[model samples]
Target chain A: MAPSIVVRDVLDREAVRRSVDTALADFLAAKARTATSQPQLGYLSGLLQDFMAGGKRIRPLLCATGWYAVGGGEDPRSVFQVAACLEMFHAFALIHDDVMDNSDTRRGRPTVHRTLAEHSAGRRGEEELERFAHSAAVLLGDLALTWSDELLHEAGLTPVQLGAVLPLLNEMRTELMVGQFLDLDATGGLTDDIEATLNVNRYKTAKYTIERPLHIGAAIAGAGAEAMAAFTAFALPLGEAFQLRDDLLGIYGDPGTTGKSRLDDLRAGKNTTLTALALRGADAAQTARLRSSLGNPLLDERGAADVREIFEATGARATVERMIDERHRQALAALEDSPFPFAPDALAALEEIAHLATVRNS
Target chain B: MAPSIVVRDVLDREAVRRSVDTALADFLAAKARTATSQPQLGYLSGLLQDFMAGGKRIRPLLCATGWYAVGGGEDPRSVFQVAACLEMFHAFALIHDDVMDNSDTRRGRPTVHRTLAEHSAGRRGEEELERFAHSAAVLLGDLALTWSDELLHEAGLTPVQLGAVLPLLNEMRTELMVGQFLDLDATGGLTDDIEATLNVNRYKTAKYTIERPLHIGAAIAGAGAEAMAAFTAFALPLGEAFQLRDDLLGIYGDPGTTGKSRLDDLRAGKNTTLTALALRGADAAQTARLRSSLGNPLLDERGAADVREIFEATGARATVERMIDERHRQALAALEDSPFPFAPDALAALEEIAHLATVRNS
Candidate 1:
């Protein structure tokens, strides 16, 4: 195995971390300038910035770290380019996801549509306020997606490496699209069975959030299939745990910590496993009330409280927690069978991170 | 110049033309193979076919033609790939446009969101039918867009070409988004002067419909600035003519030929140059009545006729027609100024086609 893993304290990875941030910031700065040269460019760029401003730097760091992991000898700048690509795609998903969920806020601010709608409403024009914002946001999502591809292709990756990774990115997007659809479907009527929902969760969240980043980084590093397979196996289950844990947080966590509305799923009527299980096991009366409350935005403090009561009464939260725990265990088990003889330290460190992510305090 | 340009009919333009029937069939075949692989893939894929299946293939053909126009060597397959990219982008626009317009029908079929909503109403026990369709269609649009970037990057474009063109594609989408904002601005209040309206028309319609296609083709052909400038000069006015003709047809042409309701703009209270002109010149009563009838889907035949009468009395229709003619002439004049020297026969033929585009048989 190549000697590229940069294992130390997460804090100590600052040099690599700074490189990742610089790469993305430079790209965004340049891209944003160009994007705003035309009229109303300010609005779109502002939305883009707000949608993508800061994160745990998890995906990009994984990209850079994975590149380093596989013994890539190149400048880490290129890895940051790849990382930027990953984040741009993530931004694309978030923008569209917000619209799909009729979500009002993101990252602790009003969402693009919500903001636009509010502004338009203040001006007393629905045409300017709602549809324009939604449509433009949709277009901006596409623009970000195109930029992700642009950054990847121009990231100074070798032709061979670029070629190898292009199809994966393509498949990644397709899979994410499918996963989002499955998620929406599962919400509506539970047309997909439990297996289907899990698969969707795995593909949409697990793979995109973790596996694809690692695979792409490994590609840049020229890692072999054995490494990729092991990495994917490890990442997928970990990713599932990540999302399932998020589902838990969405319900029970404090809003200030997660920076999302507590129990938003109840308001959105998202048919999460927690919700689905609650619906399945509830008595007819409970089920009817739950159905009516699925998207009752007017669900006031009492409404949110009453809904939480039903969730606890149904024991769905426990079911979700159990699922999360199982996935976490599976992810760690995959790492145990990992084939790499290199970087036991990094592997061990990753296992620790997975645990923290799944059993997140927030 | 390359030898392929004059090889055959407009349909025979190796860069641009294909049998519409054949391409649609191919799109369907490719689309079918996609959705069945995952849970929600089928749902989104079907929505794409709904929006994409019926266009005149003009944009795709232009994409192909643009590839050929710059003296590139003949390769039908490559042009098809390029053309496919344009159609995919257009499909993306249509899906979102449907939502923006609150449009119920497109190309003699139900629009994406409306169809989803209608399907929900049909399904007896389904909850949130409108939400289901909107979410489904948004995901579908994302997939088509995602597919477009994937297809283009893998289109065997060189690094330099990809660098130049992919960002162009991104910029174009961004500009279009900005244009959409301007469109909302103009339509919401109609306070913009006629000049502003014309500029809005140029950005929103001409650039999207014509100039971008020409640029896309030139970029593929590796056209230098001299070539690009010439191409843009040729396309801009031609594109304006195309859109102005559309505005005219929206009100005056046969519904059978246009495949939309006659004077549909009048019924919808569209804020085009025609309407802007009418509104500017109209008295209090006419303006008030015009506002009421716009976008009212339930407007009866009599109501539509009243609006049309107001349109004629205002002389906006004739004013709009004259503007269309002026743009057509400018387009031809620009062709004469093009730096490339093709055969007089070719020039004459193209000139004739431009005339055919603007002149009505009736």
Candidate 2:
């Protein structure tokens, strides 16, 4: 059987996000019912529900658009289920990331571990409470990962669809984990390796955030080799651009708008592409300043301002902005050259998402 | 086609164990080759290989026995692959369990987190290295869980077999996580609730180690309701007995034979059935001594002896042994009334396992 051509229609991003949210809500509610026998499970499910309520649903949007790009039509239920699965997987990733980074807040609220620790204040000694909170968060993350698989299994895919999708999903999970390891290894050790930093970004963000979700959705619709290639062509550049914009925002975005502290990346000494570039370009005095200022747990606003000045003086900020613009343009060109004849709806959505990702303050 | 009768031959327990180990080795070796691009993954794989070399292979044994109990034969390759998947999942569980318990050692070797900390000692400050090790071990556990799923996917099962097995796998994972949460919540608080402690043992050990693996293997062979009921009737009681033996060993077993410190459980204030029973039977002075001694991180050899005296005086030790014998008897009776007529080989192997699990000093 020949693959069907993609259909053209104006993409409704808001509508897609709403449908994905409803799928997540309905799925979690069902989980709540199943967890009635284990009362403690209710607390975890509630925390996960609260954590998920604040997501922008970018991956789900990409997934829905991907299905549309491959001529998928008729019932939208399966696609929505798979899209919600991605969101749940993201929650797992973020919760673990917060614990690893020892961050106190996420999305402008206390992080999962912090909230748990506070709740147990009267029950445990200070040191023991902190340990309990950390372990509980880790377990919760494990549950999210496990439940994400449940969502996929219950999505009602045919055997052929599952066979096509499982390998890609496995590969995506491994790549993300490996990327995290690289990121963890690089932390607290300042490096001037631009290529290495970019490599981490490619694995952690480019392939994971963009390519895999699109590929998974297209696979669900039985898209062929040419369509898959087109997705990679569009996804890699846009995903890299997305991370680059994130790096910029980490140092520059307003906390109220971004729902994250601007000082976090600096304080944690995250080895991002911008930092690598700046370190490579800095003079001896500037290098010493970066070395001393970064990774200081007690870094204050004055120290942060000095670090920002050095970053600007080294031209890192401008260079990153240029990188984002270049990748965004390349992504748009890839979309234009898609082999699927009726991919205009996907193209429109991709263009809008590209703008939102690269130009946003958050 | 009629369901084939289970064939009778005294099972080669050692041969099944060897095949499962080979499958695990080959799968992890392939993963090592695939992970060459990310050098850091090789270290994790190496650590995991070392960690796995010392395991008792209990769950894999049960999985294979379950298959044989339901007429599986003549091509052991797929069964071995699935059995290895169970072992890998157990590794994930143990690695995370160690991290949560803040354990310093396991199987007479440094725990994963402790080893990771020592490895990073040269690169980070003492406190910083400890935190890094904890986070890294958590990530490694996540990797182990993800790779276990990959093993299941690549096991080359037919679609029908996969459909039968996936739900059992999901349920097993969820049950284990809930069990962990319950255990975590009850730690460090003295409780006289024997039922609650037993509940933790049932979910954490019985369902996870015995029932689910059997159910998964039985499902692979398309066992009917009667066969499933027989397996559960036997599994639950035997599983509880296995854990009860473990609780006794934790306090009474020799360190040289067990390859674990006897005082670890008492010092951690574990709410085992034995401890709960002792607390219930203790007099006022005995209760005060129990509270002061248990969970004392610095509790030395003398303090441990005192705790042991209290356990004996309160009759907790003898009671736990009685519980084990009762459950063992029930499991054997259930086996005697097997619904599958040709399950003699499985029954023989299971009986031997029960003896080893209950009577061994280690």
Candidate 3:
């Protein structure tokens, strides 16, 4: 029997998410089917599928929105496929990030390395098995990266579209790596350099998470230079606001709602703008407490509470909230002044996205 | 004054290596120049440059050869750039492999992780420093992988050339990853499954090292089906023989000549065909001795001697030699009966590569 058809509106967030999910599922299914001789590939593909199921697909949503913002063409199939590629690339980034952070859980479940280690419980010594799991997870991340490229190549884009998109995609990948390196270099060291933290955010989040996705989608729709610049203006501030919300949530959000441990960022000694601002405003004793509590592997709930109290006492928390508000306003202003003349539905969708990104708890 | 021009012949192995090296150096130099704002990138690029200087450049040479074998066009610049891309990809693979194996050295120098760890000395505790180094090395490897793609995208190939090469490149990447997974899955265990070991060899070495590179170059030259098939037939057996020679060198070659510790493969208990054959032909006591010595981290020179004796006594070493000989002969036979009409110089170069690959001491 033929399947029931679901008419997907590009402006409908739920529909966009569902469409991207379907595209991703179909792509992975083909991969798994073709990997009959390599059973490990089938197994890895399943792992990736399960891992992907929990994502919010924010990048894909932005991509589709950006396409529409630039007066996208009739067919949305290739747009959806490219969106799936971005999601796959994200999976690669996250899998490697977890390995680097030595994180145990993601999305309220064991991380990829932890899952693999658990799967091989009795097959080898604990240490050996853990090492193997880490190595295998790295390989899996590489595969995801490779497959992301494959998805884009097979996304049915015309030569002109491919040509336009490839350079931006390359830039995005390199920028993310640069951001990751900066983040890694800054880890384990407490700093009061708010500008440096924002620099990291600009590359890691502003460009990678928001701007590039928008550019890629717009480019697919044959966006002009003015439209691309408009995307950057709208994207950068909103992306920063999104990350600021994420940092606050990392320390304050409810575990059940966020599906993440509040302590992970603190435990990793992440030098977020919030922490940097807090350090900048801290008194001597508060600074000492911040230094000891952050990046401590054995940091307890009591320690985190101490940190939150210090953040409040130093006015860092208030400052970050203010910063998020300012950025959100800037993003909206860009959209209002946009020279590209976005359609009414696209404009509405982008406004909603900017609002949700800035104010969301999770 | 103009620089002195050196005439380059693709069939000349040394000239091909030089051209590929020059291409890679130029690429990395451009990357370094562009990364002025990101100083870490410049530093990482320098590290990669040093790492690359030590490679054999075999893959690039073979790629160039394959291009010529199928009647290449006049301009060799794009071929060299693509060859550089392959070499860069190899760097990514080797960097990750060293991390997975926890190897200390490559080409008589510290491995990337070890070098990074040493560089970070005195900045952190030993364990933390080691962890950071490994993570950083993974990121660096990722950069290499990303840069490899950039190299290909910027290689100035016609759309038709790119269309021909991309699928083969993708398949090569996937094949390498699959081979790596299989090899990782088999580490730390001694098995008597000769066929299984050869399966790993076929993927890890045969296709990745030889066949796919040839296919990519041949595709760039728009090789007909008959020529592509002939390259595969010549490649598979020759690749297998090359790896078999490498296996012997890993266990028996002098450290001075091979620039690798002879004890590493034995200590890792690699499930090579030679080891598998030895297990298959071993007596009970010999088998027990083999099991104990192989994969033992503390295996010493005396223990290695014992394993070597077992290999000799069971004729496994001899059988591997015979296998290498047979494979080498088969590759030559395929070349002799090649369906594509090869130029005399190209045919001569392929024969030389085959002979040197199977019989080289290093």
DockQ of each: 0.55, 0.77, 0.74
Which candidate leads the pack in TM-score?
3
List where candidate 2 sits over 4 angstroms from the true fold: A1-10, A338-342, B1-10, B339-342
Q: Write the per-residue lDDT of candidate 2 for residues A124-197, one digit (tens) a residue.
A: 98878888899899999999999999899988999888888888888888889889988988897889999999
lDDT against the true structure, per candidate, is 0.69, 0.85, 0.89
Two-way TM-score contest, 1 vs 2, winner: 2
Query: lDDT tens string, model 3, A203-306?
Result: 89999999999999999999999999999999999999999999999999988878789999998899999999999999999999999999999999999999
lDDT of 1 at B357: 57
- Order of quality (DockQ): 2, 3, 1
lDDT digits (tens) for residues A313-351 of candidate 1: 887777778888898889888878778744766676567
Q: Which pairs clash in model 1?
A: B15-B64, B16-B64, B16-B65, B268-B294, B268-B295, B269-B294
Q: In model 1, which runs have C-alpha deviations exceeding 4 angstroms?
A: A1-21, A35-37, A126-128, A190-193, A280-296, A303-314, B1-28, B34-39, B124-127, B160-164, B283-285, B295-298, B344-349, B360-362
Worst 10 residues of 3 chain A by lDDT: A1-10
Candidate 3 Cα misplacement greater than 4 A, ranges = A1-8, B1-8
Best by DockQ: 2
